[model samples]
Target: MDKETEQLIEKAGKVYSENFSMTTCFERAIFFSWWCGINDCGFCFMSALPKEKTAKETAIRHESSILAETWLCRKLGWEFGFFTGGINAFNADKIESMLEKINKVYGEKVWISLGPIPKKLLERYKPYVKGVVGSVETINEDVHKKACPSKPINPYLKMFETANEIGMKTAMTLIIGLGETKDDFDKLVNFIKKYHISKIHIYGLIPHKGTVYSDADIPSAEYQAWWIAKTRIEFPRIDIQCGIWSDRIERTSLLLKAGANSISKLPVFRKFGTKISYDLEEQTKLAGREFLGSLTKMPEIDFDEIDRFGFDEELTVKIKDKIKKYLNVMKKN
Candidate 1:
């Protein structure tokens, strides 16, 4: 590892030693996007689609990059790593081959956050992955369609459903501040409950300069805190995550207090010609929280026992009622 990465690991270890005992759900992990391809999702600002590469060439590059990231994750002592990128009609055979290679070489410590994937392809890829994330961004179909015109919400939902059915650890991401209302959030909570999703990543939109929603309003820290608290209460056992995009120290600290337990895509090493990102560790320190290493084992989830509001109907009603009351108060103020 380079000097910078070494220093980061040491600092993270110190933070972990100091804070791990006090927290119940404070874990951290890193992610890499091998092919930062062009996404038709109009809300993205960070996409840089490769123009000159062929499908086979792109597949090779992505596999090699993922292997390197796996090595870095192991060296840095992170317990989990993620493969993320834009939606492309990638060759299923090539993608599966790459995933199989990564699993064989690095073990099942990697997860993927690719957008919508076909059910057959997803099933073929399931055993090679630790988890699969199909981020719905928001539960409001209108907002979702408007934000991601090229990508429909139904396919994303199907991806999650299929992953769950295949016994693949499933996760989702919801972006706050995208014109979604409290009712939308409630719908998201209900969907997660219905699916028994293993993890949920909540991010506030960071309008990039080139994105269609560049001039969009950022959600308030207070609103984010409220949302996080609501999600925690609604899904008490699920791993709620905050990302580097929402890494302001005070804001992150508030999120932790509000029941967020993990931070994802922590920059441990530089790749894809981007600068080394270490905001997660710094944020953890500023939050005065422990930096628990990446996920070691999948949390045991009893899918059969998880009631789709049958067992927790009263709790669900109470939480939604509380959220409605709180939103009313905010509106009044």
Candidate 2:
């Protein structure tokens, strides 16, 4: 709110425009594979320890949904699948089959970030995935251990090193307002610098029922904006994405101005039939940026590129027919 801080944030905004050549905070699509995982994270809202509760929804999911969702992401003019949750040793076969099929169509537009996978296991995914994520909520080891008792930070560091070594893009996830101090922020920047990390997905802690911090306060819009701008100022070329949570949806536009290139987790797959965050859309407009916030208006469908991949006839036809029908309905509307 002060002049100096305001001016710095403005500078960060300019850096984004200068580097990316766009004021648009593009809405990237990221849906989950949430089914089975050891939910030892006190801050986690989804999934549980296997024996603690049901632990997950189910291991077996419709594989066809993978192709359909990937196509849907393309139709909406967004990035390919970035999956998280599930895909563990217990139920790797079914998930691997789906991702393998996805690789043939979408190629390297995928990344998975639920947790660290061993070097051998991660390499296998390298063929289909373009990037991998290491969750580094805080560089302060004390804070990290207290917050995530079961999750270790060193493996994520190793994961980053391996990902870079193997010629894959390296990304990270960090939750703001995890009781991290100002010094921890500096450590975070240093960690990124050391690892040559490319992208960061910043999440605000939103308390959820049945979690340890269910009554925790969500980070303020101003705090979120300040940190994001600081990160952008430090790493102008780094890909920064601020999360938009429904709980604190009011912070939407301010977050964009803080130098996040996109509101990267929009549940955009739901934008097909279900309504999207029109409020967040309004916020983007307020920030003078564009995002796909409605299904009524559609982007130009690139059929040639779609056909060029030589995907299965059955899957291809299914997606195309769906698109055609949707387009027709849009035309009528």
Candidate 3:
């Protein structure tokens, strides 16, 4: 990173420390409710996903698996159940049913990322969810339309508007390397001003194979930090989550300094198995922030936390047994 961006990041860190205090929480748990849904987003990897894995053509992840993933995420100390899937007709009802079950078990730990549902549906989910999030990737109408083709920015803004009107917290996800303009960033500020979005998730776009930009360059980490820092400088109070995968968890320290309060996509699996190199707690601790759960270490399956973060006694026993077996099996491996 350049000196100027470094200074800005430092400034953002100070602002974050002053306003929110520096605590990084791995609160996001992305449960892919469906997969391989057809999308017009030229940059998305789903477009390249095979027919069998795609939602519209083949099968979606089972509801049991979906619920299991949520339970495991909550148990692993993630704070929100972020339900996202490919665009399809069957998604709405299935998501509503899953939300009902999750609401009963986890109580307002839901956030839906399914694209552009009706206003009434958003209202229906209010009782079951903490908030709703959408990818308002960019407010550059023409840029969004040209790249997404079918998925425009307005519909997501409408969803966000409904979320705000219904008193649910709102967040928008934006990709940094998608030909975003300076004016686009300016519009994002106005967008948060207009819609009152409480959080913004930023990622550097990594071009996917079989897509139009398959051969495009990946945005450097410094570029990612630049935008994240800029955002923190702009909205010092807004929650900023820097997107990371299992491979790049070490970036947690850098992002924390760049003013990101959280990072994305922990290594939690459907059956609660994780395969990763970085130690999440240590990484966040080195960043001078705290992580909510032990990322690599499994705790003693405490009953108190089970009641607080997991399901009822019967289900908890089943889950606990499974976890123990899984750990033992890993030990042998």
Candidate 4:
């Protein structure tokens, strides 16, 4: 590693250790994306770009990016890692192959948010994945349809049901401020009670520039906090997470008091123009929660083992170059 990279790693390690009380905990998970293009979801802030490669080539790149992210997660002492891309149909074979590889290295330490998938496919990959997130975004069908024109609400609910039936840990996200009413929360609570979801993520919608919803109004922190507290009261045993996008310390502090016990997808390094206001440790401290480290005891991982996960030399070099750029940019800033 170069000097800048070394500094970042050291700083992250020290801050992580100081903020968190345990060596292994579920809250110490990181988030990365396997794909950046749109998945035909109109409400998505991410825009679709023209396809540059065949399906096979795109699949390879996705797998390679995931492997590289895994290596970074291991180095950061995070207990869990998740992949997020907007709802898109994936090549099932390619995704299965990628999950199998990740399971070998991390052993169910990873989760993924794929909008909605088939039941058979979920069952096939359930053993390799720790959890699956099928975000309905809103319980109101009309509101959901308005936000995501291409994706329907019923299938997403079905995906969660299928996950529960197969005994896979399941999660769902509710984005507040999408013109949803109190009735929507009641509907969601009933669904959660019936489905036995292991976790619930609450995020305030960010009106990204150039998106269809860019002109939409942002929800107040107080409004977001109220629902978060309500969810905690309704589901005392389940994990409630404040997502990365809702980053204000004041909001997060209230969320913790109202019963949020976890946070997800903290970045290991801050890139330019990123909106991250606090690191994992800082967020945990703000909420007066203990920051836990890894969830399992294991020997140190060998870096060379990453090569065995399957990536072409060109892809491997590309990932390395990206990492170097990330570190150098942070150093300059």
Candidate 5:
């Protein structure tokens, strides 16, 4: 990691471990990731399409490991879920079989995160699953395309409509930074409000390895917090969470202060198949109260935990420097 990122992680540790020590929640939810087999979602490590692998090869190379890992996590008391790649590779029978096998192994813990597939397909799997997560990623269409080119053109609108019509509980995700303006944030919040989405997750862009967006810029800390705080003002009733809390705990707390009621806990998916390391339940225990207090039936969280490490000043300085470096490089290029 770079110097700036190291500083951020250090600050995150202090905030979560030293302050806001309270309840555990992120582990109570299922783990989901961008499982692409249709489109190589340039932002994820597992972006290889299923078609890119042969049928027997895919089943052998990919399926068994994931199945075994899911079963193991379930056995350890965590639900397992998968987000499909893209709508272009939509195959009903294939999905049904995958879920069927998942049910056989893990039973009633599977959640699909595909774009609005045909309604009939969703109806068929409704009985066997918990719920579907429609991670719009961002409500800004231009940003959406720029970030996830392989995604459907109007995924945000269409999926919002479908989730409402289907009456299935929905989890909508938003990625912050990505060069979106405050006006864009307002629009995204309104979109969420109109749909009455059950859960809304906010994520900051973590430019991944071996991707075009690897060098993409992250927003200013103040800007990120501003939008999140604004989101709290927009949807007070919905279950708002800062997705991937393990990625940045301070940011998670800021988003919670802004309006999100929860943080999507870490150990989201197993790396290199079926191996376990990060214990989300234990991590949650150490991750402070500002985050945990927002969960269902918990008392209103006091925002004092924000001061544990005096993070506001140091974090602001570090992020500003990083953002400036990125902007200068972008200009030069």
Candidate 6:
């Protein structure tokens, strides 16, 4: 076995030794916030901080804004909170300041999901953050840049390196409908085997209203479930979970059965986190109603529908070809 594999096995042994539930103790994405515009990834959510026109002007100051966000999370009764943002957009000062405000206001109730960060930054935030999620988004750099105009912000491979050096349990996100072939996805999954990534979040491409890849075809449930299952076997010790897999609950449940253990529920809507600034309760309620409606419609788990997504001929052929190529490449290398 390779040195990485050997280490992973040792780590897994140490991990499974604990009594944490693979499913129950698995964390949830209580409040998710990002700091950039749509990248190459299908999702287009960004942060709500200072910038040019792209940024939203808030009534509150930065530190207070952060404290408010944390307080809202506590009030909403979320276990963990995620701070998703562009790697380039965040700085050590901003992170440090944010953490201090959060800790001072909310104490130690929520976790932060700071995106790909530097080793020093990670160490600085180590005490405040419960965990980190340096999602390379996609392993393919070409696809990554094309999707995220912020090229070089969160380079796919550099994230893995930083995660290892930081000595923090990490999380990754995969965009399933980013035009990657079966081989590409498999290669990425196999590549992820060499990290301290404790969670794998799978998000189907949700065409934002305005973005380059909005109209692209989203991956089928069958494709994602198979990928999740295959990944579970390949990286048996890792934690896997569906991220924003709301559109395909059946497939998501199949993935959960295969090995995924975490889910990111919808965040309660607030004017502070929206695209506009308004103190009017009516406007807030209007947005809140829409947001709550969307959250309520999230798909429920259905095992029977998942079972119907049988391994058809096309998928079987694709998966087999990819697996064979993977093995051959590994042998050659």
Best by TM-score: 3
Candidate 3 overall lDDT versus native: 0.69
Residue 10 accuracy (lDDT) in model 1: 43
Best by lDDT: 3
Question: With candidate 1 superimposed using the best TM-score fit, by how many Å does residue 288's alpha carbon deviate from the native?
Answer: 5.1
lDDT of 2 by residue, 72-172 (tens): 55565555426665435235555466567667655555777747777787777777776887877777788788778878788788888888888888888
- TM-score for each candidate, following the candidate numbering: 0.69, 0.82, 0.84, 0.74, 0.62, 0.61
Summed over model 2, clashes come to: 0
For candidate 5, write residues 1-333 as lDDT tens digits.
Answer: 345444444454343333333333443342222334444555554544244444323333233434444444444444343434444344677667667656765656466766665567768877666667786777777777776777764654565566568776667767777667778966876776777776666667767666666788766545655555555545544555565544454454444334444445454442211111223333344434422321212122222322332334654344334434433433332
Give per-residue lDDT, candidate 1, residue 333: 28
User: How high a TM-score does candidate 1 get?
Assistant: 0.69
List candidate 5 segments past 4 Å from native.
Answer: 1-24, 27-42, 46-63, 79-90, 101-110, 220-223, 245-333
Question: Which 10 consecutive positions of candidate 4 have the poorest summed lDDT?
Answer: 22-31
In model 3, the worst 10-residue window by lDDT is: 269-278
- Whole-model Cα lDDT of every candidate shown, in order: 0.58, 0.68, 0.69, 0.60, 0.52, 0.49
Candidate 1 residue lDDT tens string, 86-114: 45535667667657655654556567777
Candidate 3 lDDT, 1-333, residue by residue in tens:
678878988898888898886677766554543354445587887766665533454545544455544555566676673677777635567678778877655556577777876789888777777687887776777767656877867778788777777788898888877777666678888888898888888876767789866887777677777778888888888988887765566666878888888777554432133445236566788878866764565545454544564455676665556556545643442
lDDT of 6 by residue, 187-292 (tens): 6666676666666777667666556765777777556655565666566767665554334434433344444444443222422222221222123232121111
Give the Å error, residue 117, model 5: 0.8
lDDT at residue 284 of model 5 (Cα atoms): 42
What shift in Å separates residue 196 of candidate 5 from its native position after superposition? 2.6
